[model samples]
Structures are given as C-alpha cells and as structure tokens.
Target: MVAGLVLGDAWLWVAVEWSPPAYAPFYARGGFDALTATLLVAALVKAALLWLILRAPAPGPLDRRAKALRRLLYLAVAYNLVLWYAFALLPDAVDAAFQLALWTGIDVLYLLVIRWRSRMLRAAAGAMLAVELAGMVNELLDELDLRELGSGGVVGLGLTLGGVAATVITVVGQRRDGRWSRGTQAAGWLSAIVCALAIPLDILFGRISSGSLAFPVMIDAVGLVITVWHAATARELPAEGRPAELPPARQRVIRVAVAAAAVLPIIALIQPEQTPHLTYTGWSMDCYDRPSFGDLKPEERDAAFLCRARSTEGGVPPVFPDSLSDQQILAYGRALCRTEDRDERKTILTRAGSARPAWGVDPWDLVYVCPEIIGATYPELLRSTKETEAANAAYIAEKNARCRDPWPRTKGVVQASANYFLFVDGDTGYLVHDPGDEAADEVAEQATDKVYDDSALIGVAGSAVLIGHFEDVVDLCLTVKAFRTPPPQRTAGWDEVNEVPIVSRSGRLTVPEMGEGGDVGAGAPMPNLAIAGKGRYRLRVHVRVDDAGEEQHLVVVYPGASRKRLRLKP
Candidate 1:
C-alpha cells in the first residue's frame, strides 16, 4: 500500500510539471521546485514497490476487513491520479478548482487509510490530513479576498481545534484498548498533546509559508517516526491480520523511481530565459541645470539682479533691466536664487518670459520665501533637524486642513511668488538656504547630466504643432515641479510641494470643465505631473476642449529610476 501511495504521488508530480506558465528554472527556483519534484519521485517509487510487494507471498492469512481496506486504498490512489491528470489538462480557473477538490478527496481517503491500516499510521495520516485541509481552506479564502477571515487566521483556529479533538479521541481509544504498556500510552498521549500545542504556535508565529502543504509535511514526519517504532517493537501481525509485504528487489526499484521522479521538476525549472518588449511616451524633463555664476560678465550680472528683484516684488515678469544682457540676467539669477544650474529656469526666463509680466516679482525672492515657509511649517524641513512632538502635531493639523481645501483662489499670486524665489536661488543650486551651507552643486550637476543624457528636442510636424498652447506649457511646468517634490513622510509635516497646477492647453476650459466634455480630455480632472523619490510612480493628465464639441484626452505616465517611461492608456 505504501508503494502504491508513492507511485500515485509520482504521477501527481508529472501532472504539475506539464502545466503552464512553463516551469523554466529561470522563472521559478528554490524550494518550490525542489519539493514538487521530490513528491513526484516518492509517489512513483512507492507504486512500483507496492506492485512488487503484492506479488510476494503474505506473512499469513488476512482478515476480510484488512483486505477490503487495502483494496479501497488502492482504488482511492488510482482515482486521485486520474483527477490530477484531468487537472493538468484543464484551464487555469478550472484546474485550480479541480486541484482543490482533489486534495480534499485525498485528505478523506488518507484518513480512512490510516484508520484501517496501522494505529501509528492512522495517527500520522490523520494529523497530516488535518494540516492539508487547513492549508487548502486558507488558500481558497485568500483567492476570494475574504479579508474579514484571513487564511492564516482561519487555518490556525481550525488546526488548533481539530488537532486537540483528534488527540483526545486517540488518547481515549488507546487507553481503552490496553494494547500497550501504560508508559507507552502515556508517551503517545504526550506526543499527541505536544503536536496539538505546536499547531497553534506554528499557525500564529511559525515562519511557515502561507497556503503551503505544511500540515502534510508534519504528518509525514510523525508517520515516519510511528512506522519505525512499530517495526521495532511489534512482531508480524497475528496470522489472520497479517498483510502482504514488498519483495526486496521491487522495494529497491520503487525507491529508485521515487528518487528520480522527485528530482525531475527541479531540473525542469532550471531551464533558460526569454526576452520581453517594452514601450514609453509624454513630456519628461530634469529640474537641475545650474548656470555658471562666476564666469558671468558684469552686464549679465546686472540683468540677473534686476530680474531677481522684480520677481520678488510679486507682479513683475521674469525680465531683467534693458541695461543688462541675457547672460547677466542668467548669471544674476543663478547667484541670487541658486537655480542657475537648472536649464529649465534659463529657458523659462529667456523664452517663456520673453514678454515678461509687468507686476511679477523676481524669481530669487520667491525661492527664498518658499523655503522659509516650508521650514517654518515643519522645522525638520531643515537638513538633519530632529522632529519634536509639538512640531509634529502642528504639522499634521496644517496638512489635514490643506488636504481638505487644497485649492485656494490666490493660486496665481502664489505661483508668481514661487517663480520669483526660484530665479534668485539659481546659482546656489540648492532648494533652500541653510546654515550648514552645503552647496547644491552636486545635485545640480547630477540633474543637468541626467537631462542631457535622456532628453531630446523634437519639432512637431504639420498643423498639429499649432495645438500646443501656453496653458499646456504651464501644466507641464507644474507637473515637473510636483515630480521634483514628492509627498512628505507621514511622521513629517505636510509639504505642499506635491501640488501641481492642472491646466488645459486651450485655456477655454479650466479644471471645473472636467467630465463636462465628451472630447479628448473628458472625465475627472487629470494629474498631469507627479514627483516620487524611488520606485514606480504614476502621472495622470486629463484635458478637455469644448470647442471641439466635447473632446478630451487622458494621458497616463509611469516613470521609474533612470527616467524610463511607460505610457498607459485610459
């Protein structure tokens, strides 16, 4: 019967290996492969040994009950193999369902087999069946995502209750039988109790893999111990109860087959690899480009200084005085604001602000004020500053208020202020002026290098170029800013740097126009820009144009380290 069980187990292994996602070792490695193959081989060898054992003469006559039970065990093993094969051929959903059913059936059969076979085997098998049932139940629950009762929680409770009940029953039955010395019965009961106690601990804290065949493994271990003890102490069964035994040669052959079956799946998993295709789209830019302040000519410095002053005044456009050249403006801005390293700043002043706003303040003033506000709100904003409990509470309250009513009517004023400060901080290349005085030159240099390495300027062809508008540029800029400053950590005060203005290229429809259009940018307001520290992050942009009779476009961008892009469709 052991041989037959082993052979059936081997067939089960063959079934699992043939199923997809293709068991290439490159994809699936470690214990998953090892255990799978081991089980397979063990099953095959056991079957071969059983056949040989059946061919050998029995030690003595057997009772009808014993013979009947043996036949049923063989039949159950056969049925299990058929079910396994069917599972392999079915679709994934169907196969999963079938496997679940099959395991449940196997558990029932195992319990019956143990009861009719040997007391020790029965106990071992019963324990294993309980564990397997617990695992299966847990797995099924997980697949359904019934979070109220998690798989681990349910399995743990079930195993604890079942193990205790089984142990109690076994103890009562053993005591009644009086088949062994009192000491032996005591030891058996003690072992059973120990196993019962271990079940809950293992379920709660054991590093056991969730939904794995841990119960079966425990049962197997216990079964082995019981089998060895029985063989050592008990002589052959009484003449009427004696069962058939495997021949020496068949037993050896079975062992060899089982070993081979166990190893095959693992070998299959170690196979080769394959290549996959990838794609990307949308506007991406780097924020660190520091202009050289030291080499700036006197006239250029004058222009930059004037631009900084005007930017701080709040309403003046990003323009320098007529007396200073573009170079001076660039240099002065870099020196005053520490943002000279970022090319975007240069571009914004030189090209975007060519017309210049009459009331806008200089960029340097905006940069200085921005950091001060951040620092004041969260003192820990300063580099290396430890957060105090009072500060943390104040920060949380501020953040909650901001989140609840994020959009203020004074957005234009705030943006103007931010732009002015940015201009002044260009040269220092640091976001804020700190007492430590660690220059942001390194960050600036790295940011500049990344921009040059990854970006390219491409002109749009035909009439489509006309579609681009000032609002689009503004949206893109805001998006870039948001990406540069990710959301603050939970323990830290809320920083508004994550907020980015969402703008429509046409300017006809503001964010309030979202979902009103059936055009290119319909539905909810899109998040056109995003900022993240590390790991995969998403940026969603939605735009709507009423002129086109309800047209909208939704753009989704996935950005990763090294500036990799993945564009998802809406």
Candidate 2:
C-alpha cells in the first residue's frame, strides 16, 4: 500500500503533463469541485493507516534460506533492467528473445525468493493487481483505436483471473506446508508468463500504446491476489523479526524525488507548443494585369536575367527568352508575322507581354489556345539551309511590332518570370498550360473560364501558397506528381512530377492536380504537409485531365494550406 501511494503520486505528475487538460481539474482537486472532497480525504486516511502499519512493523533477520531468497529478488530486478535495455536497442526478433529470457529468469528468481520468505510473494502479487486495474482503465479510454475490444477485454480479464488464482494457490500451499507449495509456485510463475505475453498482445491490438496500462494491469492483479491470500492464511510476525526500515535521510530523499517527479509533468502539460517548429518556402504569380515585359526595377530585372541564365545552364531551360533584354523580348513578340515558320513562338511571346484593354485572358488562356506551341520546342537548326533560323528571325520581327506597349505603365510593375502563371476567363471556363498536350486543347480552353467561376472545384489552383527555394519547389512538385500514380506503378521509371496535399479541414483533405480516379475521401482528419525546415512555398492552381470522362472537366480549389489530400501511397 505504501509503494502504491508513492507510485500513484508519481503517476499523477505524468498524467498532468501528458494527458488532456479536460481531466486536469479532476486530478488537481480530486474531482469536480468540493463535492468530490471525500475522495481526497479517503486517500489521506488510507495513507495514515499504512503509515501506522509501518510504524508497528519490526522483525528479526530471516533464516539463511530467506536471505538467499531476498538476494534472488535483487537478481530479478537486475534481469528486468537488462531486458528492458535489450528491447530498446535490438530488433524485434532479438528483443523477443531477450524478453523470453528475462521472463524465465524472473520466474526462477521468484520461486527461490518465495521458498525463504513466502510473505514477499503476497507483496509482489498485490503490486501486479494494481497494474491490471490501471490497464483496464487505460483500455477503456482508448477504445476507439482498438480493433477488437471484445477479444482484448476477454484476454485482459483472463490474465487478471489467472493472477488471482495463482495468488490463492500460493497462499493455500504456504498455509498447508508452513511454506510455499510447488503447485502454488508453478501457478504463480505461469501467471507471470501470461502477464508478460499480454504486453505484446495489447500493443498489437490496442488503440493507443503510450503510457501503457499493461504493466499496471499485470502487477495489480498479481499483487491483490497474493495479498488477500496471505492475509487470510498467515499470522503476523513478531515485531523483532520484521524487516528494518530505511533511515530518515534516505526516506526524505526518496520522498522529495518522488514529489518532483510527480510535479514536472504538470508543468510540461501546461505548455506543449515548445516541442518543435517547421517551415517551408512558398511561391505565387499573378497574371490578371497587363504584362509589362520590360518594366522591372533595375535590381529585379538583373535578378531575372541571372535566373534565366542559371536556368538554361542548369539543364531546365528558362520558360522565357534569356538572350534578349526584357524590353527586346516583349517587343520581339509584337513583331512576328502570322505566316512565318516561328509564328507560334511569336504568338506565345505577344500574349505574355503587357496586358491590353481587352486582355482579360490569363496566362493559362494563352496556354490553352496554343497548347502544343507553348511548351519547350526544338528550334530546328538544319545547317544545310539555315531554314529554321531565317524563319525565326522573320517571326521575331513581326512579334516585336504587335506586342509593343499593350498596357499602360501606371498599372504597376509587371513580373517577367515569377516561375508560375495563372489564367482565368470570366465566362469560358477554359484553361491552358505551357507543358500541356496538343491533344487536350479543347479541354484546356474550356477549363480557362472554369478557373474563375469554379476555382474551388479545381485542385491544382486551389488557394495557392508558394514554398520558396528551388529544392523544396522541386520536392513539392514531385510529391504532387506521386498522387497521380498508384503504388504499384510508382518507381524510378514513373513520372517524377506528383501532386501533394495542400488543404486539410475537419474530416477532408484535398490535393492539386490528381487524375479523375484519385479522389480524397472523407474520413478522420488527415495529416498536414510537413515541410521539415525553413523555406518558402507558393500554392497555386494548374490544369489536369479527367481520366474517367475527359468531356466532364472539374475545377478544385481549397481555402488554405491546411487542406489535406491522399498521402503518397508508396
């Protein structure tokens, strides 16, 4: 009882720090308000009784056999510690091996210990009983996570009953023989083994595993059974023969240590935000206003050039022209002739230039109109005729003329290369992209207008947040692409681009740009996107085809970055 009181105090501390605050007041004041004061008073009364019992206890040294048994108990404690450490460090198979060894070692130790001082078995059994009771309570609290509560409950009950039976048998044998009997001893050892097995069973089947109640359940069952049996059969020993009490200094130290251990968890529970912080880079672009092709701050213009140069050299070419000045690039788009071989390239550049009074079309608008022409195209350099180069020159001249100063300078600076472009049509619901297929032109065009009217339905462009830094952007891109393919199909050869979860709410999560069959189903709350470190990221909409029925395209947009989507299956 004294050990339990001390252990309870320690547990109370852990509960305060780790458990939900909804139960805080229950622990603080013993229950809801003064009406529950009786509980606290009862506990205090019990503590007083136990203290009195201890004061009245004084017994002489045990026989040689009893001394040997006590030494075995110490050995059992050492074995348990070693087993715990081994379990922590080894793999499952090794851990299991060590666990079995520990269990057998402990059983042998207990058998030896009981031969000399059978009364100690009762104390051990009582402890086990307390543990079992605690386990039951924990299981109830975490029932939602358990797979088969009925089976788990049956096993728990059986183990508890077995411990009780073992305790009873041990007491009966001790009374009949003036010492512990082999049958009682066998039952006790078997019960201990059953309790050990129960730990793994609970872990595999229970809902929650932390601060587990399994150990408590086993200990309490054994403890109560043995204590009851001994009390009924054994007489009290003479005071002179009782075990010696700890010195005042040692007792004080233990009490203080226990009290501190109990209080720390309460402090931790009050403040949990200190655990850790995570951040990521984000990016975004706006194309609603006219494209001020050359209108950039000196520094920004220089940075754009650097970005373009770096892009071309680093494998992925810049989406826009890097060789020409921003002004020249914009002007060149306006100068292109419709009949030239490079007419397609000229048209793309012209549309990307400053916005016109009628330029309500978004960047996606241009992509939709010229899907095949928008993405990277090889400028055919057949040396024999220089045919492609001559044609491109003519097209560039015509593009420069038509793209000239389409939007006024008063509207604010136009971004040359934001890395992302958005296109929205007020009525057509059409959308297009730089890297989209020519075969999907009609679908892209229809999606453009839908972008504005039903942005919420469109997954790719939903409340976009930019994650800054190229590496993170690439990773986000890859994660997003992963959602498009099934687990079995995903491999090194699979598409590198994948969709990632961008929005999460109550019971639903959504990702951008998944194929038609990839729906984010409603369920318990989904996991958030965890960008492990500091950086920036931009969330935006993009276009994707409907695999089920290409004719019925949908737009999906989310409110914020909190939306959840299907996890990367692989």
Candidate 3:
C-alpha cells in the first residue's frame, strides 16, 4: 500500500510539473508552477532514504560501502535543483531561499556521513534540520491560500508533505535498528540514486528522446517495481560495528570534492553574471522581436514584449502579471507615457539614474527597455483624439505666432555631442554672419557665454548676440524658429530650456544648411539674417522644442546680450 501510494504521488509530480495547469489564474504565478517538480524530486529523495534504511546494515560510522554512491547522488540532486529553478525563471524569495536551504542541508548531511563519529557532527546535523524546518515554514507561508489542492497535490500541500517526510524519515534513518531499519535505509538510498539519475535525463533528454518526460517517469516506474520487491522480501540484514576510518588519501579526495562544489557556483555567477529579473507591479513587457520597432503600434509592441521575457512555443507572450489583457497592456503603456509630471520633468531622476553622464534618457529605462510599448507609442498622442488634436493644434499655433518667421523644417535628428548644451547656448557657432556669406567661426569665438536653465516646460519665445561659431556645422532649423515680436522656442517638450547671450558683428551674414551628413560647411547652404544689418547687436538665443515644435528650435533674435541668460516665460 505504501509503495503504491509513493508510486501514485511520483506520477502525479511528473505529470503535473511537465504540463502545468497554467490556465488557472494562480498557476505559474510565481514559482508555484514548478511545485510539482520540486515535489517529485522530494519523493525520489525520500525513496532513497527508504532504500538506505531497508536494505543496509544498521548505521555505524556512516558505512564506507556506499560513500561514493552517496556523493554521486548528492551531486546529481544539486545539479537537477539548479536546472529546475532556472526553468522556473522568476522564483520568489521563498523559492530561492528554500532551494538554498535544501542544498546546504543535503551537503551538511553528507559531511556528517563522512565524519559521522565527529563530536561536531551532532551540532552540524541539528543546524541542517533547523535550516530545513525554516525553509519549510517560509514556503508554507508563501503558498498560504495561493495554491488550490486536488488529486496530485501541489503548492503548500506538496511542499508540506515533503517537508514532513524529510523530517520524519531522516530521523528514522539515524537509528541503529534490526530488520525494519535496514529495509528503510535501503529504500531511501536507492530512491536518491533513482532521482539523481532520472530527473536530469527527464530534463535533458525526456522531450528529445521520447517527446515527453518518459525518461524520468520510466526510471520512476522501475523504482516502484523495486519497492514492490523490497516490500515482499522483508530483508533482515544484521547490525554491524563501526567500520574502519576511510584512508587519509580518500578523505583528501572527499574534501576536494566539497571545495569544488562550493567554488563552481561562484565561478558561474562571476563569468557572464546571473541574469536579474524584475517583478512589475502590473504589466509585463519582454518580447523584442520585430521587423521595425518604431513602426509597430503600442498594443502590437506590447503584444510582442512582456513576461520577465521568455519564449513560448505558441500563443501570447506569457504575461508577468498574467491577468493583463492586450487592451490593459496598452492602457498601462499609455499611463506610463503620460506620467510626465505636470509639475516637473525628471531632471533629478536623471542625476539619480546612473553615474554615466548623458544628454538623453537611456540610463533610466522608462521606455528604452520596450520601444513598441511606451517608447514611440505616444509621439502622436497629443493629436490622437479629435479634442486633443484641436486643443494641441490651437496651442501650437498660438506658441508659434511668437516667432516672426515661417517655421524652419528640420531635415532629421542631428547627433549632439557631450557639450551639446554649450552649442545650444551659442558659444561655438554664431558671431558675424560673414557677408562673405559664411558663419565666421573665427569671429564667434569672441562672443561671451550666456547659458542659463529655467527647468520650464513651455516657456515664451524669445535671446541676443546669438553668435554662430557652430562646429563648422550647425543645423539651421535649430538656429532659427518662428520669432514673434518675440521668437518661437523649441523645447522638444522634454528637453531643458536654455538661453545665452549671442553677439553678431554684422547683420548681413550666412549660417550653414545642416543635414544628415559629414560635410563641412559654415552656414545654411545660407538664410538672409533679415536682421536689419548686423553691427554690435545683442542676441539672447532660445534653443527649445515643444511637442508640436516640428523637431525645430525657435531661434528668437533680439537686440543686445543680457547681463545673464533670461527666462522668456513664467
């Protein structure tokens, strides 16, 4: 009856773990999906302990006969546990801690066997038991009310029963008894060997060899038949005295084995490093496969990304918080994009984000992690709805009216260097618009620095002495904008608004026609300064972009450099 019960539970574990009921809301929610696999391994370990008890002579100084076998079983279980957790992906705290505890306890128990007569073994054994109990309790709490129970047993029930069996049987195996203890010992050791050998085959070859977990399951089936034999035979091995100590050379080998076990995992963690996982509060976006990232719609992008990021054979990418739907993912993506503070931009956040300095938002992963989802999805968001379109359109027109000239059309995004803010302020690129009709970089160097930041979102259009000493190349669109009685400022909605003093030696000058190339030129292939003849004119240059700024800054030119850079709007 006992053998049959063990056989049934073993089948339950393999069946449920291999094909988890992921349709259930709580299934695979955390590490819960692999609960059955953990249980299966536990059952095999327990069976090993049973075999050790039933088929061996009474314990005395941890027999030399199976010492090597014990070490092999331990190594196998350790490897299998590591892989199982890897398969689980985002294991919770309890799952990780429990596995660690189980590993430590098994090692400690093995150590006890090697030097069983050592007075220190008693304390080490107690410590192992304590660690196991704590692990059991931690797991029990994690699964409380989370996992539902039925025939196979899972979550709290499976783990709890395994814990109980480990505690009770392990205690039973410690005794020096007659016939019964011998059979229990034999059963226990055999079960461990079965598990040590079978699980890895199941994981490594099960699917490829038989297209299922037939490898491990069959090994388990063979284990059950042996159990039946053990039950019927009822062995009576005689108790024996403590065996002689293992040779010093053999002991040295055992110590080296233990040291290798400890060093291997640390090396693995060090090489490429362990991949970290993030548990999102709501949405899960991890898929990155796409033809063109920016082209896909937000929903489609989200449909592509999510789940601490793992590949599935078919269907949707596994949602991290699995309850999320396609539409909800979109809604969540929108919410994240729209989360720009109505009050302030993420300036401090940039400072706090990463130690590496950057002019853009790459260090902080609000959108860079998933481009399709929240990154490019909201580019046209201001005009997405009819009301938003009308309101944003009117607002843009009102802002642009400040610029006196037609909005300069930007050709493309120009890569800015580390001193981009310096260029934005007019130190490098503008002074005398050389009537020779080139932006005279030589003359612009004489202009004073007048860069100041207001941290304002939408500031008024308007600046002076906007010397254009640009690095042999300046995008005309950035230099000129719709300047009203004041000029239009292009803040790009998120970029900082800065103004600095600019001086022009003469009004009649030329600026480069900057484009997507590495060509060298001084000004716009060149624009008429329209500046009623430039001589000793003060210019406060505002380099900014708004959502509707058409990717161009509103360069408002005024007369006379300010004592300092001025804030154009409240």
Candidate 1: list runs displaced more than 4 Å: 1-68, 83-128, 134-149, 152-248, 272-570
Candidates sorted by TM-score, best first: 3, 1, 2
Each prediction's whole-model lDDT (CA): 0.34, 0.32, 0.37
Per-prediction TM-score: 0.25, 0.22, 0.26
Each model's total of backbone clashes: 74, 116, 85
Write model 3 residue lDDT over 254-348, tens digit each, in one string. Answer: 34433432332233222111222222222323343322334446554344433322223255333223334334444443444454552222443
Q: What are the C-alpha RMSDs, in order, of all predicted structures?
A: 24.8, 28.1, 20.3
| Model 2 per-residue lDDT tens digits across residues 310-422 | 23333433344333443443333333312234545545555544222122222222222222343223223111134544564454345323322211231211111101211
lDDT of 3 at 254: 36
Cα lDDT of model 3 overall?
0.37
